[model samples]
Target: MGETTQHFVLLLLCLSGLVHSSAAFVFWTAVVDISYYNNITNDTEENFCECGVYGQNARVETTSGIVVLPRDDPKGCHPDTVYNWTSSPWIALVKRGSCNFSEKIIAAVEQGASGVVVYNADGTGNSTSHMSHPEAAGVVAIMIGNIQGMEIVKLVNNGTDVYMTIDVGSPHGPWITSYWLYFLSLAFFIVTTASIAYFVFISANRLYNLRMHKRSERKLRSEAKKAIGRLQVRNLKRDDEITNSEAHMCAVCIEAYKVGDVVTVLTCDHIFHKACIEPWLLERRTCPMCKCDILKALGVEEESKDSITTTLPQDATVITVAGGDSLFEVPLTEPVRSDPERQQHRYDNRAFEGDTEGRE
Candidate 1:
């Protein structure tokens, strides 16, 4: 989870950086000059910083005097705002608002205005923003603060001609526009949030499965204990054995049963030393010789079908417990009965009944 969060933060930062670099504003410098008192007032002059240039307006050069548009044009586009190719190049000055920036720039374009200057709305300070006028390609456009635009507007309205100059200025900031900043912030936030959410969901699922697996193991162990309890147990005796003809070994340890040797017998009539088979049955609940689940055979409720990972014969020593494919088959034989009625069951015990039936 920590690693995931770190990666998300890095990705978000990269996105923010991309938006900041790609969406930048170009700064423009406007030199305003006004002839006052017939050049006797030293000709008032001021330099103003301009911002918010359209992409098409970047790096544009304008070397003409300025012209202010009529205040009450029907299209908010004064006839004077348009430039004539035959005349000297001119820059048109206009107030902001009453329509979109694109519309205003388009109106100026029809009149041949080589460049456009839009001032801020009434009483708004000189703060400026970038202009996106897709239709105003090939035209230079810049915005000046309201205070500066109004000062220039007053001089032009009073019939005082103001000479203007527009030029590319110094580069600025890592964050060029507010809209880009907002957009990047929003995108970063969304991606990071989603990544975190997914991480949490996966973690929760794994924990849930782990708990369920442990619970299942416990239930399997409990059922096996009950099944093992129902199996038959006996002690072999030397005196009860018939004259030595052949020897039989315990299937589990490959050792011969002796007097006082305790052993267990499964329902399938397979026998194994008690200590050996008891542990195995308590875990698996299946006969080692035939792979039959004693629990299910006895009609006990089960969680599911047998889920052992390995396939092996049940209730027999033929199956290797060490995770190998090798099998060792035990020899089948007939039982020697000292008595008739129960003699049949004695044969399956792999030896004559010994130790007087039940001394242990």
Candidate 2:
């Protein structure tokens, strides 16, 4: 589950990078202005002019008079033609042709025209195009809808003067520079910073847990060493020295303790081979039979870096009951002497009241 969450975070970061670095472009638009007086209406009204920059240098303030060289000839070019431009600036209106856009613009340049407007072919309606005439520089050029061009043409044929204006329109560019780009940058920064912080948090948490585990192990080992040192380790005595009944079989290894065999006595008074219980104490820190912490039984506990001592009453009594033996109490008035290196201990107040005289 942790690994899945981590992968999800990584995937989000990748997506953010892709979105932040993506590219965007803007298209050019033409602004055409046209106006003429209508004899029937007896009023001069401006015509709706929607133009697109078709070629280079399309920045004419105004152009008037007739539109000439209007059709593409056999060579797919609108050849030069003379126009009576002494009254007003000449605006050349041409049709879409098979020849390159530059060829048509060059033809108009030869005819002394001030600007050029290229309308669409017969089948295409008012669809405008962006035409770049790099070959004919400083010559204002633009494209208009076929329907619009035809309207102006009819007006001109009627012998009415039509005036028009042209210039470069609004600009467009990369998406990153747009308004929404700011929002994207903000979100990207927030998510990226959060991811970095989360990564650092995870690293610090893991390190802390590791250090705590190592400290716990060291603490347990320290207690184990103390308990092992205090414990009695010696060779098993002969039958005459120590009674055979006290040398019971080890519950851990399930083996009897033979004379001369090396062994250790636990705080519970239970005995086992020294080798067997040391590893068990280090791992489990408990007696095999009673399942009690030997460290606790030995009165040696690791509370913290500093030792905590608890005082108990000095005068006490030990009571015990054995099978086939009567119950009795033994008084204990001795204040245990504290060893310099070991923690103060309270001697156990339990003793076995066995029938010592009935043994023989």
Candidate 3:
């Protein structure tokens, strides 16, 4: 039975060691990262400080034990009583008296002790009091039993050699925890990289699309301008052609008037193709040139008040005249021979001469 118990205890000790080793690995390997001003910059690096190790200036606490040291000397106290309740680096022995644990510790701090170990002066059970450097200075304090206090006090009084030890808990740092943290940090890095890549791609795509749209709009505007210019050029050409046709010849669809056609003269003397002017006069009763009122020109005194109608020609005649083609014919539509001894008088006198001869 004794051997079995020893084996079980050894196994428990081994398990405890493994657990501590694992904890140490995890703490030492864990990566700490800091990110500041994320919008402006992303700078990250590994932290090198071991998480499981304590620094020399670290704050710590002591187990249950009364401390004894010089209380009034500033040189012996690590931190002066002004800043911390007690001076550090020496055990303090405080007797339980008229004050509570808080008061006792305050007195001990005022006396410049490194650590405070308060003990009950009258009672048997000494409630362990944990001391804190409420001032944020690193002073370790603990409480101990009356017997422990008396032992330390006896050494202080007798001037005998005494040594004190403090046990502080250490962090566990192991390899597995280090690797785990390292991988986690790596994963975070990959994710961050992918996110940045995606953002860049989307921005580039948007910029490209914007450029393309602008280019397309520019092209469309250019084409429209060209079309408008062409249309204006075509209109100008058409106007020039119409002016030339009116100057050199009549309109292509209508010929000029022949000699026999009835003619209405305009005040401006700008004659048009008769077929064209006839339709125009029927619609507007005015000469095509100078906008002269044709009815007034033909002797209507008040052209606007009168309903003028066209009359048949009086003494109108047709005289055959030569034109371009072989004996191409033309006619005079008005009485060109208006003299009394002309053809009309000759025809009238012949009949009279014949009547005179018959009477003789």
Give the number of the best model, judged by TM-score.
1
Identify the superior model by lDDT, candidate 2 or candidate 3: 2
Order of the predicted models by TM-score, top scorer first: 1, 2, 3
Better of 2 and 3 by TM-score: 2
Q: In order, what lDDT does every prediction score?
A: 0.58, 0.59, 0.39
lDDT of 3: 0.39
* Candidate 3: RMSD to truth: 32.3
Q: Residues 1-360, candidate 3, lDDT per residue (tens digit)?
A: 242333343344346674454432221111111112222344332222111112222244432222355445322333342322232444456565544445445555566555554544545553333333344344444444565556555656565434454444322333433344445446656887999999999999989877766665455344433332222111112222222321222221233333333332233233444555555544444543234444444443432222233353566443333322322122223333445345333222111233235447
TM-score of each: 0.40, 0.39, 0.26
Candidate 3: segments with Cα more than 4 A from true spot: 1-176, 232-360
Better of 1 and 2 by TM-score: 1
Could you give candidate 2's per-residue lDDT for residues 1-360 as a string of tens digits?
Answer: 242333343346446676334312333355777778889999886865546554544443344444554443522274553444544466777667777677777777676667777877666678876666667766677777788877777877687777776655543335423344445546766988999999999999989877877787789788888888999887765642332443334445644556787777777665668888888788667665444568877888666423323364664444332322333322222333355122212322121112122344
TM value for model 1: 0.40
| Clash count, predicted structure 1 | 15
